[model samples]
Target: MKKQSFHIDGAKVTVYLDGPAWDGKPSATLGAFSCKTMQSGTSVLAQAISFVRDQGLNQIIGPMDGDTWHSYRFVTQTDGSPSFLLEPGNTPDALEVFKKAGFTEISGYFSARVPVVKTALTTPTATTDFTIEAWNGTHPEALFDQVFNLSTQAFARNAFFKPITRDDFMAMYMPMVPMLKPELIFFARQPDQTLAGFLFGTPNYAEGPKPTSAILKTYASLSKGAGQHLAHAFHKAAAAEGYETAIHALIHDDNLSAIRSASEGADIFRRYGLFGLKLNG
Candidate 1:
């Protein structure tokens, strides 16, 4: 990872060239990221881009923080709604800075919300060899290890995917264990008692007071219908616990999960984008 900066006329811009290979292959791309401008200054962004190109980087992809494992994307649009926990927050000027600097949207992501009561209580039937269970808070390291293993395979085809270590995965999520409500986390298991799918949810503490809203954070499945089943179970459980709404968070525009969220009656309330700029290297 490399950090670059420039200043002109009291305006300063900081950019991090922290791109790693995508899906584990070497590339000429250097992510133009951690971009902070003292104000909405296109000259600053332009200079930062020029610095990366001068270093012989061919393409710059970001608003990405090195990769998807860390924070990325600019909040491109919203239905004028309140932000949720962990959602990307960016100013309108940030969008303008990227656009003025010749960046184009390379990927799109969105978050949706639905009334918990609107989600049907019908549970998805597991195939003959699989069963479903709740994730009780126990041996978190072991649990995350299982999740990390499955995530590697399940999310292998996702955009910008790279293999992250189990330790990194745990470090990213373990601190949230105390806030995890058991009913909101689930696992789909094969007859051998191995996990085939998982769903993770948390109460929306971003609201400051005790939150009645919930966020469906992350899920992955190796089999068909497992994801839907997990969603059904969690939405039902959340509603039963008096959660007024459920937010399906940060789904890629091309992901099948978008269809599932809509089928469950969720409304797209927020959109985020990651942009790419082709430098004249």
Candidate 2:
């Protein structure tokens, strides 16, 4: 993707020319966005808009680094909780910076927390179509390859979805292997040994060395009921491991995952959004 950076006053933003489509039209994405003052933010955004329009694109989205595979969205609301590991964060004025630049919320997401014991007790028993297994902490590379494949298939239809190379996906996750708790990551497999789903959870390392909460970072399913079964297995394992809470991280508002979180008694503690701006020709 071709990228250009724009700066105004103390603010800076990067414009990615070959961004994912918006409403079926080509879009330019703004990333690495930062600004101390609204005036500077607006000015820099104007420069980005002009540059994109000159390239024959009229739609823009940000503050995604490039696509959904990377960090994106601004924290729009919070309940005073501290951020978790790998959570995307921005300056206090980040949301307003985009709003003042004529950007509107194009997508919404949330993070929720639930009691591990409660979720474990309430989750339905596993379906017979798939059996859940935990990662054995061996051959970490192979583990992520399976995850990357399942993720690409499961999230293919998601909004702003973009395919990432397996190497890029592995590079993004391999470093976290040391922090992973084998019991918290699960794989759902069919009778023929085909992988149907996976759940990757980690301890809230940001909460310090001995954390009480587990973060359900991500999970995806290709078969019916596999996702729910994997989640059930994760919660049971987390509770057994003495984790008191589970954080369902970065769930899209309309996704079944969000509904599952709520049904498991998770309460929304934070909200996030992606912003978009439409330029006039």
Candidate 3:
């Protein structure tokens, strides 16, 4: 996981020499990227490319901060809406800069907004073998451990996936414990108490002190219908708590979560893309 940094007239980029592979090819990641102008950005990117090629890598992805667990992707499109809590954002010209540097979209994602009432009404009743329960805010560490385990399993097959240590995962989420609403976070368990799924939702604090929108940040399921059941429970609870809107945040374009968001009448409000460049030997 060696990293090298490059600079060009104030523009800077860091290359992670041991980044996750892209399409089974050796790859590097261009992260910690910044540039004040297109020319500087392009120059810096070219330097990064050269550095990656010298390492015998065939692909490069960015502007990820080493991995997907942190800030990544550029806001390629938007509907004039303000950014949300924990949303990844970049300079307005960042996407164009990447395009001019011979990078193309390697992955696509979007965030959508829907009325809580509509989502709650459209979601089918939970009739699965698993039962959904709200977190009681007790034993917070144990709860996150369950979430970390389920997330690793559920996202194992996702593109550019990488394994993270449990300590790192906890460090990333522990601070948010104070902001979490027990009702909005749920877990699906089998009759024998085996965990099947989990949903982590939070209020849109980026909106204001008392936000009306709830964010469905992340959710995963290992059992059939458990995902939908967890989502349904979240929406119902949000509506009961007087939340008017729900934001389905950062769903991959081809993921089932994206389809579920659309089926619930969510309107696409913002789009993002992870850019990639192919290195020539």
Candidate 4:
């Protein structure tokens, strides 16, 4: 535990940044990631935010262990869900602390666990017309680029305060892309090579209480059913391999399309409390 306090010189507030033995990276991973209230450090949050402002970082979004979007969750987990489904430590009171400290909830993302029942979506998924295929080294990485671009389009407006750069994605999530499932990751492309939508999912391997997480994605102009089928493949693989459960993380409440899809999603463990504070310059 490398402890540091900033901004509040003589105040009773302090923030402690802890590094789990598993991580190997920057200060973002070192601090600002905890699910418990007692574990959150006031001084640490204050200092980190100050640093962001000083560095001209106008907007800071988190409960992120680091910048990697897939790394952890901001919500408080329920004991009933498998431990692997847990996210970054969350405390209910932290909401008030951030509020008092001048942070406001810019958005609320939802996470919930659902039983792997039937793919009972009655509406024909949007991806039915296109032919799907597997991705391997032999195939062009550009195909995956198409998938990613389509995903970017689908997720274009979700709580993004500023344009997130590609370099950030490469630094954060792309490092783990090699480990993603080739067969389960689907692509819906037309004969002209236009990407319709993409269903993306992977095996979860992060520091947490759960053995696996099943938060999958369906991003595109295609059928929801196509993604659902692919997701089932992932779930089946996870359970057959002796994994326990999955978590649907970061569902935007304001997005009505997502809400409808998530109506039958999972019983939410908790709503992630996000507060944004603008400093008086």
**Candidate 4 C-alpha lDDT tens digits along 168-259:** 65555556566566654656566676776565655555534443455554334454444544455545544555555545555567754355
Candidates' lDDT values, in order?
Answer: 0.77, 0.89, 0.89, 0.49
Better of 3 and 4 by lDDT: 3
**What lDDT tens digits, residue by residue, belong to model 3 across residues 70-125?**
77899889998988999998887667778887889999999999999988886666
* Regions of model 3 farther than 4 Å from truth: none
Global Cα RMSD, each model: 2.9, 1.3, 1.5, 7.9
**lDDT of each residue in 30-100, candidate 1, tens digit only:** 23333355353666667777777776665777676556777778888898888888877876777777787
Per-residue lDDT of 202-260 in model 2, one digit per residue for the tens? Answer: 99999999999999998999998888888888889999999999999999999999888
- TM-score, prediction 3: 0.95
Q: Number of the top candidate by lDDT?
A: 2
lDDT, candidate 4, equals: 0.49
Work out the TM-score per prediction. 0.88, 0.96, 0.95, 0.62
